[model samples]
Target chain A: MVLAAESQLRLDANWIDYLLVAFYFAFVLGIGIMARRSVSSSIDFFLSGRSLPAWVTGLAFISANLGAVEITGMSANGADYGYPTFHYFWVGAVPAMLFLGIVMMPFYYGSKVRSVPEFMNRRFGPTAHLVNAISFAVAQLLIAGINLYLLASIVEILLGWPLWVSLIVAAAVVLTYTALGGLSAAIYNEVLQFFIIVAALLPLTLVGLHKVGGWDGFTDKVAQGPGGEEQLSSWPGTALAGFDSELLSVIGIVFGLGFVLSFGYWTTNFVEVQRAMASSSMSAAQRSPIIGAFPKMFVPFIVIVPGMIAAISVQEIVEFKETGQGSVEYNQSILYLMRDLLPNGMLGLAIAGLLASFMAGMAANISAFNTVFSYDLWQTYVVKEREDDYYTGVGRVATVAATVIAIGTATFAASYSNVMDYLQTLFGFFNAPLFATFILGMFWKRMTPTAGWTGLVAGTAAAVTVWVLSEDVTGTIAIGGQGGAFVAAGAAFVVDVLVSVLVTVVTAPKPESELRGLVWSLTPRKDFHDPDEQELAWYQKPTILAGIALVMVVGLNVLFA
Target chain B: MAERKHEAGAFDIRVFIGSLLGIYGVILLLTGLFGTSDADLAKSDGLNVNLWTGIALLVSAALFVVWSRLRPVVVPDDPDEG
Candidate 1:
C-alpha cells in the first residue's frame, strides 16, 4: 500500500508521450460516456445488470487486482527476494481461484445471492452477515484510500501539481466514470486497462532481458546478487518466508499464503467476486476466475523480471539495498527500469499504464465498496421493500460518497509513509478469520451459527495477539522475512477452527433441510453443474479450463525452478 | 452455456476496445516507420521496439474487430434481469 506512493517515476516523457497519454484518457472517458446508457436499474448500477460475458468479467477480475500496488509490491518482492516471489502467484493464488470456480461458485451463483455478505446471511444468519458486511465495507474504503493516495502521488509527479490538487483530480476521474455508467463503466475500463497494462509492461521486460544479454545472463546475475543462490530458486524460499528451516518456509508459503490468505482474499472478498458475480450465467460466473488465472499466472514475467533486472542493473537501488541509503527503494524498481530502459514514446505508454492501473484498483475498491454499502448495509438494515430504481439512485450516491470518504482515507494513507507492514498485519487479522468461518460453515453442516459468531471474533483476537507479540506491533520480539503476518494468519485459522468445533458441539446446528445447497455434502450432484440445462462443448467446461490452468501453473513453477 | 447479453451495436465492449487498439496501433506504427531515430533504437538495444510492438498490436486489433464482426453480441429479448 505504502509502496504505491513511495517511489516517484521521474518520468522524462516527451510531447509524443504526453499526446499518447491524452489519447488513453480520452478512450477511458469515452467508455464511461457510452456505458451510461446501459444504467437503467440497481442491478445495472451494482452488478452490470448481470449481463456481461465470461471474457469481459474475466479480464475485469484480474484487472481489479492488477493495480499499481500489486505491480509495485510484487516487483519489490522480486528485487529483494528474487525467484521466490513466484510463490505468491503460483502457490498462493491459482489453487484458491480454482477452488472458488469449481467448488464455491455453484453455491454463490446458483442461489439468488448477489454479494458475498448476502450469501453469508443465507448460510450463517444475520449476525455473521452483519459482521462480514461491515468489516468488508470498512476494509474496501481504507484500501481505496490507499489506492487514491498512490494515484494522486503519481499524478502529482506527472503534472507537478500539489498533493491535494492531484488527489482531487485523481479521485474525480474514477468518480466520473464510476458515477456515470456504474459498474459497466468501471468493468469496461478495467478490461481496456488490462490490455494497456500488458502492452506497456511486456516491452519493458523484453528490453530489460535483452540488456542483460538473455535469460541465462539474467539468472546468472541474480545468483551473484545480494541474496546469493537462494535468489535463483522458487523452493526453500527462506528469504521470503522469514523461516529458519526450509520445511517451515515451504509450509508458510503453502498453508499460510496458499490456503488461508489466498482463499480469504480471492474467494471471499467482494471486489474480485463482484466481477464474477456480474457474469451472464452460472457457467460464465465460474469461468471468470478460471479465465483470469491464465493471465494472472504469466503477469510475473512482465512485472517481476523487470524488478529483478533493476536490482542488478540500477545503481541507486543496488546501493540502497546493499546499504541503508534510501536513495532508491526496492519498490521503485519498475519506475527506475522505465527511466533507464525506455525511450520517449514507449515511456508515455508505460506512464499511461501506471495511471490506468492505479485507477483500475481504486475503481475496483470504490465499486465494491458501493455495492456492499448499498445492498448489504443500507438496503438490508435501513430500508426494505423500496422500488428498484430507488436503490439504483442509492448506489450512485454511494459511489460519490465512497469517493469522498476515500479522499479522506487517502489523506490518512499519505500520512503513514512506512506503516504498510502493520496495515497488512491488520488486514490478515480481518481476512484469515472470515475465511476460516466461511470454509468451515460451507463444508460441515454441523457448524452452528453460535459457532460462526464465536469463531470469527475469537480468530481475529488471536491474530491481533500474535501481531502484538511480534515486532510488527511491539518491538518485544523479532519476526523477520515476512513471517509475522504468516504466523498471524496461521494463528487465526487454527483458533477459528478450534473455537468453531468446540461451539458446534455445544450448540444446535441448522436443520439439514435448511442447509441444502449452501453446505457441500447436502447439495445434490447435479446442482453443482447442470449439464442437462446447457449443451456445452468439452472445452467450455469450467473443470477442463481450471485443470489446464493448474497444470500450466505447475509447469511454470518447474520451468522457473 | 451462458445466456448471452444483448450489447446494443454501438456499445459493444469488444468494438470499443478494438477501436482503441487500432488507433494506438496506427499511431505507433506510423511513428516507428517515420519518426524513430537511431538514438531511440539504441536505448532499447538495437530492436525497433515501436515497429514490432505496433505490428503486434495491429494484428491483435484485427483479431478483436473480426471477432466482434463475425459473431456479434446477441441480446435477450426481455432484458429485465435484476
Candidate 2:
C-alpha cells in the first residue's frame, strides 16, 4: 500500500530544478539586502515610513494573507468540499476587505496610531490596550509558528528533506529580512511572492483545464466521478442541507463566518491591516484593499481549480480506501498534482513559489509580532521614554525572539493532527471576541473602557467554553471544526454584545472631547478625496472598482451554483 | 525629511524584481517550448506547464513594471511628524 501510494505521487527532482530554486532564493535575499538601508527609524521599520503607494501595499495586503497553509489547504478543501470552498474567499473575505477599506481605514490611518492596540488604548483605555496587545502579540506568534511548521512539512513531503532543516532555514531567512528592513522588506517580498504564486498556479490551472478539455469538460468529468457532481455545487441546497448537522447552516455562514469572523479578521487583525496602513496617503490606504479585492475575487481559480482537478484525476484516494487507512489524505492533493503534472523546470519554479509564499507569510507575521511587541508592549511597559533608535533596536530584537519562539511553537504544532483545523479554532477563540470589542468601541459612544475589556474577556470565554464542551464531552454543541468555530464565534459575539451593553449602561463613558477621532459618533470625518483620484476616469475610482468586484463575486457565486 | 526625499528617488525595487523575474522567466519558457524531448514531455503528463508558467510570470512581471511606472512611490513630507 505504501509503495503504491508513493509511486502514485512522484517526488523526484534533478539538479536543474535545484538551480532554479537557488536563483529564486538569491533574488529574495537580494531584495532584503537592498531594503536594509531604508530602515533608519521605528516608523520605517514597522510601517515602511507610511510611504508605499496603493499597488505595492495592495498586493502585499492580499499576499500577506496568503500563507503556504492557506494555498495548500484551500486547494485541499476544493478537493474535499468542491466549489463551496470559495465561500472562504468570496462571502468570507471580500465584503470584510471592502468594509475595512471604506469604513475602517480612515480611523486606522487617520488617527496616526502606531498599532491596533494603541488604537484600542486611544478608544478605550490602558486596560483595554494591555488586553488587546497581549492577545494580538501572542496570536501572531502562534500563527507564525504554525506557518513555519506547515512549510517544513511541505518540504519534508516534497523533497524528503528533514523537518528541522526546513524549519531552521525558513526561520533564518525570515528573521534576517524582517529584522533588518522590517515591514518594508516584508511587504516588498510579499509583492514579489504574490507574482510568483500566481505565475506558478496559472499554469497548473491551464494544464488541468486542457487535460480535461475546458470548463464544461472539467465540470462534466468531475460530475461523472464518485461524489463529484455534488462537490461542484457552490451552494449545496440550503445552508442546513449543505453542511453537516454539527457544522454551520446557511444562517451560520451569513452571520458567523461572514459577519463575525470575516469582519473580525479583515477589519481588525493587525497583521493584515498593517499592509493597508502603510500606504502613503488616506486615499492610498482606502484604495489599497480595493485593489487587493480585484485579485482576491479571482484567487479561487488558481488555488481551488487544481484541487478540483485532482479530485477527478488522482487515484491515491482509491488506494487509501483499499488499504483502509480510514482517512483520505486530501491535504496532499496539490502535491499529487504537482508531481504528476509539472515538468522538471516547472516543478522547480512551482516549488520556489511555494517556498516564497511560506517566507512571505512568516515575514508578515514576524513583522506584525515585532511591531506589536516593541510599540505596544516594550515601549509601553519596559521603557516608556525611549529614543527612536532605541525602539527600532527593540523591534529588531523582538523579531529574532519571535522567530525563536515560532520555531519552538512549530515543533509543538507538529503534534497536532491537522494544523489548519487547529488554527481556525484558535482564530475563533481570539478574533471573534476581538471583533466584538472593536464593533462596540468604534460605533457606540456610550460604550465605556470597562465595557470594552469585559466584552473581550467574556466573548473569548464563551468561545472557549463552547469549543471545549463540544470537543471533549457531550459533543452536542456545534464546535469541533470550522463550522463549529463559526457557530461558537457567533455565540461569542452575542455574549460580548450583551455584556458590553450591560456594563456600559452602568459605567461612565469617556469624555466627548477625549473621544474625538476615536468613536464614530464623536469623530469628525475628514475628506479623503484626492485630486489625483478625481483626475482619473469614473470607472477607475476606488468605489467603482470595489463595486465591480462585488458584482463579479456575486456573478461567480451564481455561475458556480 | 531629507532622508525621506532621497528615499523617494531611490531605485524602485518592485520594477527591479519584476524585470529580473521577467527576463529569467522568458528564458525558461523558451527552453521549455523548444528544448524538451518527448520523454521529458511524457514526464509532465504531456502538458507543458513550464512554458505556460513562464508566460504567466513574464506577464505578471510586466504588470508590476507598468504599475510602478504609472504611479511611482511618492514620499509624504514629514510623514512621521505629528
Candidate 3:
C-alpha cells in the first residue's frame, strides 16, 4: 500500500521535478514547432521525408523499443528473476534482429511499401491486409495506453505529483511535439532521450557499484542472503543455481521467447517499421534493420546490469531489516535505489531521463498510431486520396486524438493494482493474434483471404474466450479450462493457423505471381542496379563496429557477471 | 556467360548455406569447449554464466558482421534495382 500511501502524499512543491518536467515539455514542443516547416507533405510528416540516416533510425528504433514499460518492467523482472532477465535482450532480441536483417528486411524493403499492411495486401490480399491493420491498431492502443499509465505512475512517484497531473503532463509533452513534427519530431526527440537516459543510468550504475564496494563485496553480500544463490543471481526461486540455464527453460526462453518474440517485435511492431519507412531507398530500409540490430546487443548492459546491481543492493538492504514497500513491488526497486543512492544535480538528470523515457515512448506510440490511423484507417475509409497535405494533416490530427485517448486511459490505469500485469494481460489478448496473423500471412503463400480473416478473428476470440472462461478472471465459455491468458492466446494461434491453412487449401489460392516481388526480393535480377549502390557507405560501418562494440561490452559484462 | 549465371546462383546458395553452417558450427564449438567450464567458472554468487552466453554471442556477432559484409552482392544489371 506504499504506492497508495505514496500516491496520497504528493510532492507537487518539488520545484526541481517540476522544472525538469517543464524543460522536457518545452524541448518536445520546440521540436514540434521547428518541424512544422518540414512537414508540408504527408511523406515528410509521416516518414521524415524518407531521408533519416541509419544512426538516427537506429537510435529511434532503440528508444521506441525501450518504452516506459521496459525501463520499469525489466528492472522489475530483473529484481524478480535476477540476471536471467538479460535473456530478453541477448538471446531473444539481438539474434532476432540479425535474422531479420539477413532474411526478412530484404523482402520488406524490396516491396517498397509505405506501411506494413500495404505489404500484406501486396503479398496476400485485402482481407489479410485489413485484418492485420485492425489487429495491430487494437494492440497498439492497449500497449500505448498501458505504458502511458505505468510511466505516469513513475512520474507521480518521483515528483510526488498526483496521477492525473502526472499523466496530463506526460501526455501533453508527447502530444505537443508529436502533433507538429510527426515521425521526424518523434525520432528527433527520441535520439535526444536515448542519450539522456544513458547519461543518467551509467553513472547511477557505477556509483551504486561503488556504494556496494565493487563486484566482489556485492557478491559476498548476495551469497550470505537467505536464498543463497537463488536469491541473489538466479531467477528468484529456480533451482538452476550453478547451471547456465534450465534445459527446457533455456529452449523456451531462447527459441520460443527469443525467436518468436523477436520475430514478432521486429517484423510486426509498427514503431520499428516507422524507422524503416524513413529509409531513402529499399536497401536503406533493409540495411536499417541490420543497423538497428547493433544497439539491441548493448541494451542488456544499459538495462539489465543496473538491474543486477539493484538486486544486490536490495538484498543487502533487506538483510539489514529494511524490508519495506520499496522492495515489495520489484519494479519500483530501481527507483527506490535511485532515490536512496543518487546525489543532487545527478538526481535531477536521472529524473529527467526517466521522464524523457516516458516521453520518448509516448511520442513513438502516438506517432505510430497517427500514422496507422491516417494511412490504414482514415485514408482507407474516410479519405481516399493519398495527397501530401491531407494525409499529413490527418496524421497530425490523429496524433493529438491518440494522445488524448491515452491520457484518459492513463488516469484510469493509475488506479489498477499492477500496471504491468494489466498491460501484459491485455497484450496477451491482442498481440498473440497479431503475431499469428503476420507469421501466417508472410510465410504461407497458399493462405486465402477468407482463411486469414478467420484465423485472426478466431485467434483473438479464442484467447478472449479462454480468459473469460476462467471463472477466476471472469465467467463465460468453459472450454480449455483455466489457463494463463498467453497460453490461451497460444492455443488460439495454433487453432487459427490450422483453420487458416485448411481453409486456404480448400479455398482458391492467390497467384504466386503476386507474391514474387515481396517474397523473393533476395533473388538476383539481371539488368538491375540499385541507386544507392555504393559499397554500404563507410560511416555505415560504425553500425557494424558499434554492433561489435556492443557485443564486446556485453561480453565483458558476462565475464564479470 | 550462361554457365557463369548458373554458377552464380549456385554460389549464392553456397554463401547463404555456408553462413548458416558457420553459425551452427560456432555455436556448437562454444557449447562443446566452454559449455561445461563456463558453468564452473561463472559460479559466482551474483553473476550468472548464461550471461556469458552474451559474450559468446558478441564473438559470434563479429562473425555476423564479417559474414554480412562478405555476403556476395548480387550486383543487379540495372543500377536502381536495390
Candidate 4:
C-alpha cells in the first residue's frame, strides 16, 4: 500500500525544472534560426550543404539513433533481462557501425549522390531507387510517429497536460526547427541534445550505482535478485534470446543479431547515414561513424547499468521484476529513478534531456524523409527541370507534410499500441533485404537491374514469410525474443543472396563501364581515398579509428563478460 | 578534377554547444549551491549530487567554450560576391 501510494504517474518537477526545460526549448529554436542563414540551395536545406566538421556529424550520427526508444527501451530491456541487454549494443550495433565507416562510406560519399536511395538510382536504375525511397519514407513516418507518441506521453506526464495538447506542441516544435533550417537545424540540435542526454544519464547511473553500493555490490545484489545469477553474464544470452537451446541462442546471437540485423540496419538506414553524409569532406564523412562508435560502445554503462540498478533499488521496478503483476511499464525505470533520486534542478535537466532526444529522433526522420521525397520522388517523377531553389522550397514543404503525417500516425499509435509491434516486425522485413541487395550489387558488378529490384522484393518477402510461419516472438518455427527479429533478418539475407545470384545469372548484366563508381571492384582508388587523407594525423584516418574502436569494443566485451 | 569546396560565414556548431552547455551548467551550479536541501541530499543517497554535477557541468562547459573560442569556424569568400 505504501509503495502503491508513492507510485504516481507524474514526476515531481518544480518551477526551476520548468524553467530549465523552457531554456532548452528557447535554445533549440534559436539554433534553427541561426541555421536558416545557411540554406541557400537544396543541398544546404537537405544535407547541411555538406559543410559540418567530423565531430559535429559524428555526435549527430549517434544522436539521431538514440531516440526515446534507446534511453527507455534499452533500460527496459536491462530491467527485464539484465546484462544480456548489452548484446544489442555490442553484437547488434557496434561492428556494423565500424564496417559502415571503414568500408561502405567511401562508395556512398564518392558517388556524390544526394541521398542513399539516389545511389540506388544511378546503379540499378529508377525501379530499385523508387522501391528504396518509398519504403524508407514510409518507415521513417511510422517510426517518427512512435517517437512523437512517446514524446507527447512524456510531456503529458511531466506537465500534467492533456495528451492532445502535448502532441501538438511536440509536433510543432519539431516541425518549426526542421522546416525552418532543414537538416542543418536538425544536426546542430542533435549535437547539443547528445551532450544533454549524457549529462542527464550520467548522474542517474553514478547516483544509482552509488546507492546500490557501487559496481561490486550492484553485481552481487543482481545475482540474488528475481532473475537470479543468470542475469549477471552476457554471453550465450539465453534469457535475452528467448530460446531454450543454448546452441540455438548462441547461433541466433552471432549470426542472426550480430551479422544480419546489425549490418542491415546500421549500414542502410538513411536517418543515421544522413548525418555522416552531412560531414564537410569525404574524410569527415568516413570519420563520422567511426567517431560515433566510440560513444556508442560506452553508452550502455549509463543507460543499461542504471536499469540493472533500478531492478534492485526502485520499488516499482523491483516489484515488477519480483512479480510480473504490477501496472509498471519497463520504460518507466528511468522516470521512477528520477522521481525518487534526482532533486528539482536535475529533474528539469533530465526532462529537458528526454525532450531533446525525442525531438532529435523525430527531426532526423523528418529531414531524411524530406530529402528523399523532394529529390528521388518529387523531382524525378512528379516534376522535372526546375531550379535548385525550387527543390529547396519543396524540401521545406515536405518537412511540414511529413510532420503532419507523423502526428496522424502518432494518434493511431496512441489507440493501437500493439499495432506498433506488428508494424515493427513488418518493417524489420525491410533493412535486411536492402542490405542483401546492396552488398550483392556493390561487390558483384555483373548484377543486373532486374536482379537488384527482384532481390529486394524477394528478401523482404522471405523475412515476412519467416515471421508469419514462426510462433511470432515465441520461437516455434523460428527463433523468438529480441533474437526472433534477428532470425527473420538472417532469413531475409540468405534468401536475397540466393535470389540475386540466380537472377543475375539469367538477366543481362550492367556493362562494366557503367559500373565505374557504383561497384566496388570497378571504382578507382581515388574514389575510396580522400586526396588529402595522407596529410591528416593518424587518428583522424577512418581505418585507424575503426581499428581502435574494434579493439576497445573487444576489450569491453572481455571486461564485462 | 573536382575542386575542394569550402563555404564561409556559416553557423559554427562548437559555439552553439559551448554556449548552451555553459548556460545549463551555471544554472545547475547555482541551484546546487543555494537551493539544495537536506531532503534533496537524502533522496540522492546522502551525496550533494546537485553540487557535484553542477561542478562537473561547469568544467565541461568551460572546456567546450574555450575550444570554440580558440578555433572558431569562418566561411571562405563567397564566389557570388567574387
Best by DockQ: 4
User: What's the residue-level lDDT of B5 in candidate 1?
Assistant: 52
lDDT of each: 0.80, 0.75, 0.58, 0.80
Lowest lDDT block of 10, candidate 4 chain A: A415-424
lDDT for A318 (candidate 1): 79
lDDT per residue as tens, model 1, A22-98: 98889887777655544543223334335556777888888888885567778888888889888878887787788
Q: What are the runs in model 4 whose C-alpha is more than 4 Å off?
A: A1-7, A38-52, A386-397, A411-427, A473-479, B1-10, B78-82
Interface RMSD of 2: 3.4
Instruction: Provide the lDDT at A436 for model 2.
Output: 85
Candidate 3 per-residue lDDT over residues A26-55, each given as its tens digit: 655666665665345322333332333466
In candidate 2, how many Å is residue A551 off?
1.6
Quote model 1's TM-score: 0.92
Candidate 2 chain B least-lDDT 10 residues: B1-10
- In candidate 3 the C-alpha lDDT for residue A487 amounts to 47
Provide the lDDT at A288 for model 1.
93
Candidate 2 residues lying further than 4 Å off, grouped into runs, are: A1-10, A38-52, A237-248, A318-328, A388-390, A472-479, A527-540, B1-10, B33-35, B59-82
Model 2, range A1-561, lDDT digits (tens) per residue?
222333334456676577777887777777666666545432333333355556677888889998855687788777766777777788878988888887788788877786788899999898888889898888888989988877776666666656788788768867775655455566667787887787777777787777777898888977776555666776642331234642336677778878888888888898888777767667778888888988998998989889888877766743442353633466667777777777777777778778788777887788888888888888888899968999998987888889999999888766654455566667877888888888788788889999989999899889888877775336875345466667678878999999999999999998888977777788765434444666767655668878887898888878877
> Candidate 3: where are CA atoms >4 Å away?
A1-5, A8-25, A37-52, A231-248, A314-328, A382-397, A411-427, A465-489, A521-534, A537-561, B1-82
